[model samples]
Target: MYTEDLKVRFYETDALGHVNNTVIPAWFETGRLPVFELFTEQGNLYEVSLIVANLNVDFLRPVYFGEMVTLKTYIARIGKSSFDIGSEVWQSGQLCAKGTTILVNYDHKNGHSVPISEAIKAKLLQQTHPDHPLAS
Candidate 1:
């Protein structure tokens, strides 16, 4: 339920003057920082790193440059060693695109997936959304 507002720059548009499809994913990634901070134990995004394991996006409508867009992010699920996050981009209150991403608990030093720490699991559980799908 966290939101971040982003401006649609002209350079983000394609030849048709519509925001490029690829840009939505980038927006989602950008939006995740604030949401992650809300439920983080250390109150910092730098304390941990989330690595994407899977991503699925759905484009609902076209967005033009010079528009103010709102990116909404939330935690959908938390697993033993992974988590699922959801995001939606809205232009003037209308959905432009929505997506879900599966992220793994990563050991940056080892460069491999690791189990979610108890502290992280507790924080994520505390922020669970009833209207959203949640998993372990």
Candidate 2:
């Protein structure tokens, strides 16, 4: 699992004084950096070849600017050519949001999805939490 600390920026808030809806996805994307890093060799994390098959977010509560937040990211499941990344956003000890981002491994050169490698699977397994909904 990966834990990233972030502050709800002033610009990220809406008129309601809570974080804007758009900010959640951006934070989730930031929380995914570590996972992406593992897929690429050192010093080349930006060169990714995966596609986002789907993304869903459930905002459990409002997050205001200046609040300290923690976004915990973990592997939810591994499939033949895709995997799910689950994340929970916590603010002041409350579960503020939960979501999943589905990504498919792709061979950009060939322009098609590719099966996940065992080595990569094992790496992902390590990043999964025991309480994951899809965990055995």
Candidate 3:
């Protein structure tokens, strides 16, 4: 699993004085940077060969500003041409939110999905979380 530490900014808070629901998705995206690197060449955006197919988020607790939070990301499942990423946000040892994002390997030039290479699959498997259902 990949972990990232973030400080909640005041501007991210809502009228309820906690982070807005929208912010969690952005945080989850940030946590996926490592995974993105696996599909790109030297962190080049032009080399990205994947596209987000779906995203889901569940808020469990309110996250407040000025506090540090940790975002954990892991490969939840791998398919022929797509994969699911599981992510979580924790604040003060509490799980604030959890999410899943599905990404499909694509051939941008051809405008179609393509099977993931075996080498890349091996790399992704290394990132699977032990607690995930699909983890060996």
Candidate 4:
């Protein structure tokens, strides 16, 4: 699993004083950076070969500005040409939000999904979270 530590900014808070619901998704994306690195060459964005297919987020509790949070990201499932990424946001030991995103390996030039290479699959499997529901 990959972990990212972040400080909640005041600008990310809502009128109600808690972090805006939209902010969690962005934080989750940041946590997925390591995964993105796996698909890129020499850290070049132009070499990325994946696209988001779906996303889901569940808010469990309020996250406040000025607090430190940890975003944990991990592989939930891997398929022939697609994979599911699971993420959790925690503040002061509480789970504030959880999310899942499905991404497909894509051939941008051909405009179609392509099978994930076995070498990449091995690397992804190494990062699967032990607490994941499917880990058993």
lDDT per residue as tens, model 2, 21-80: 888988889888888877887649657767899999999999888779999999998998
Ranking by TM-score: 4, 3, 2, 1
Tell how far residue 53 is off in model 4, in angstroms: 0.4
Model 3: worst 10 consecutive residues (lDDT sum): 127-136
Error of 2 at 47 (Å): 2.7
lDDT of 3 by residue, 1-136 (tens): 9988999998999987899999999999999889989987678966989899999999999999878999999999999999999999999999999999999999988999999999999999999887777632
**TM accuracy, model 3:** 0.95
> Which RMSD does model 2 reach against the true structure?
1.5
Residue runs of model 4 more than 4 Å from their true location after superposition: 133-136
The per-prediction CA RMSD against the true structure, in angstroms, equals 2.5, 1.5, 1.4, 1.5
Best by lDDT: 3
> Per-residue alpha-carbon lDDT of model 4 for 12-98, expressed as tens digits?
998877999989999988888889899976998679898999999999999988789999999999999999999999999999999
Pitting candidate 1 against candidate 4, the one with the higher TM-score is: 4
Query: What are the per-residue Cα lDDT tens digits for candidate 1 across 1-136?
Result: 6778899999899999899998999999897776567445678777666778999999999988977999888888878788888888999889989999998878889888888778777766655555776755
Instruction: Using TM-score as the measure, name the better of candidate 2 and candidate 4.
Output: 4
Give the clashing residue pairs of candidate 1, or none: 79-136
lDDT of each: 0.82, 0.87, 0.92, 0.91
Backbone N/Cα/C clashes per model:
1, 0, 0, 0
